[model samples]
Target: MATTTERVKESLLGVEEDLNMSQPNRSSFMQHAIKDEQTGEEYLNEQGFINAIAPEGEDYHKIKRDQYSILFNVADRNHKGRVTLPDWSVFNNLLAKPDAEYEIAFRLFADPTTGQVDFNTFKEIYARNKTSDTIPFNWDSDWASLYLGGKKHRHSMTYPQFAQMLRGLQGERVRQAFLHFDRNGDGYIDPDDFQRIIQETASHKLSDHLLTNLPTLCNITPGSKISYANVRAFQNVIREMDLVEMILKNAINKSSDGKITRVDFLNEAARVTRFSLFTPMEADILFHFASLDQPSGRLGIADFARVLDASWHSTAGLVDQGVSGPSEKPVVSSKTFLHDILVSVHHFALGSIAGAFGAFMVYPIDLVKTRMQNQRSARVGQLLYKNSWDCATKVVRNEGVRGLYSGVLPQLVGVAPEKAIKLTVNDLVRGKFTDPKTGNIALSAELLAGGAAGGCQVVFTNPLEIVKIRLQVQGEALKAAAREGEQVTKRSALWIVRHLGLVGLYKGAS
Candidate 1:
């Protein structure tokens, strides 16, 4: 029955008084301590402040009351006795409107609720606030800044930090992120400007010594804007540089005369990076590199850098001169080759075992293959056979149980060689074609090797495959036909071998 303005004003006053009384060692005049006439001990007393105030329990009630006031008001822009779509632009508080302004806007417009707001209506309330604001939200400032800017959040905020922040703001994280990163005063963040800002902030924080070394460290060409990749590359360098600077900062704090020496750098780098300097494969790869006539331990950072720089130059990309001078191509060291062989043997054994296991488990695929190959055409076979179980049952009913394992003998022999060869070749090709020095395998090489392996698999297995197909196709038709009808003689593997010869077996190959 109260007007929207009157109720809001009264609610606000009640809210203010509640907050005041809730403060430690604080109370309103009406909520002031009352003297016991006998003991003079001041006991707090006020029904209006205690009962009328909106405690956390009454929060939903207050919000509902607010919404009801809006709905009842004739001044409300939205018609149909509730907040609606067009009213969202004008109404500052969407929760007070009949239609949802934020997330509920879609739902409200869609369902046109016969129901009202509840405790879960928190999202609706927040949405009203969000849609009302004209400016887009920013994340890096409001959200990421809390963690990334401080020592607490700087090193890294884990999944918990992400969850807590998301829950605290409800689901406004994306809106907040967009608004914070919209640095240009524009509503949207363009990729270029976003990248530049990150780079500038990162570069700005480099230690003084590193900053002094920048002129020499920079491989930039004059008058050229850096690409996003180059910017990231520079950031990587800065991160490493910052690690070195952190040691100096520690030394400065300790007031030690000694700088972080090469020994110190290696020890610290190993500690921080926990560099498992030699994974068995990497060690083997490195040993291979060391075995070359050039005689290096392995591909160092510098050697790797050279390969990358050359790649960049060839691609007509912004090239870093720091990487370009001279370098030897890394070779497979003997130790590395031995390691590779050991690994290859282990994986070959494992893959063969797995393939053999799967062969027994899903041997039905072989049955399906046989039926399909035996058919005059794919569609006829598929329609006639129905499902896999039906085909199996039909095969047994017509021929016998041996029909299920038509190609099994060749398949058993094929599994080991096929799996072993395929896996071993895949590893070798991936290692070989990938520039060991640069760690980038050429895309074309990957495609070529993959296609070649697939083709070889089919080629090597074709003869056995043809035998299996012939066995699966056999039935009582030829037996009956031979006895009386004499339409077509049933063909056996040997019969086909004698009549059509080896070429005849590979009928499906073409």
Candidate 2:
């Protein structure tokens, strides 16, 4: 007797032949039969693909494994046991472009001829290359001759290979910088060289706190340079130095001789000391906007003070005008004011609830969108994902239908406060303006409210937004960077506060 799969295949074949002979154009019967056959085939294919990539000793497909729960669910399209060639093609096409590496396997398994990728082909290509030590060909040969200098070699690399390349380069660079910084040549950096070169450098002039923290910044020994493994630990230091140079460059460029003076340096130093962080360009923009003497190209302490005073006064005036106009001023009586306050509170609460509801609704899609955005470019047969539907289907297949909601909680938590504050403030502001003739309020109050609400929201939500965006964008690489001491890991809000402070958030505020 034939196996269960063979029986099903014979059954499907019989249906196809019957339909072709009796009803070649039988719309209803043909459609139903085709759909059923396609569905079964899809299911079988999906299972085969999963089994192909599944790790050994696991009864279920590897795609059903823990870490890949999200990825597997996303790739399984058509609720079929398999993802068809058309489905795989959609994934492969996108993977071939920029910023989409997750779909690497689709590209690799894609049958360039019939435009279909079967399980055996996917398995053979994937498993064969995976055991490269036994292969005859060198996997590291350069294959970019078609684009560059006809220097063809076998140029294909896995994630590990690419990572090794970057690590190797970083190691080499760190060795060079370490050697370059080791001035005294006593086999290590001496105290005198450290003070003269590192401490005295313009880049190291950041306040005492940062200077004190410098020793903790890297994992290197006091006298020795950093190792190759610890090279990423200097990223923050390099980033800080870049920012400092950017500020100084702008200041020097302002001078007629294109040179910085002591006073110019002192002024910038004082500003940085006060703010704890500064983006010089943002400061210049703020000054330009607030300058009363438009063409002066210079601002004094008075101009700065006036700008703050004006902002405060204008904000207050807008609020006052919103609450009390010619119509009635809402009777300003204590009882009336209390009633108005209660009403405003209700409005705010209602607005918040609605905002929260809306946020939770779109969160899963947002997660998928974010993942798609974070995807990196990759070659065929090696990608982790295919396309949006593939990603979603794979998630369902691997993670029991809930994998798509992985980061939903954090996203909902981040967006609700920002949205609620914006909406409530806008309603309150619009409530202030009363029409004189028709007792109707204009939309102007809403605009002012939006501005104020937006400012407040930025202060509160920016840190969360920063962390969320970074988490979404960089994935595990950023987290690893933090662990290696390359970045100062802190909560999004506190990190922003410590590094940027109040003025840092409002970097370009006038």
Which candidate achieves the best TM-score against the true structure?
1
How many clashes (backbone N, Cα, C below 3 Å) per candidate?
Answer: 16, 40
Q: Which stretches of candidate 1 lie over 4 Å from their true place?
A: 1-332, 335-344, 372-387, 398-402, 475-502, 505-510
Report residue 481 deviation for candidate 2 (angstroms): 12
Model 2 lDDT, residue 288, Cα: 38
The TM-scores of all predictions, comma-separated, are 0.33, 0.28
| Model 1 TM-score (2 dp) | 0.33
Error of 2 at 320 (Å): 29
Poorest 10 consecutive residues by lDDT, candidate 1? 317-326
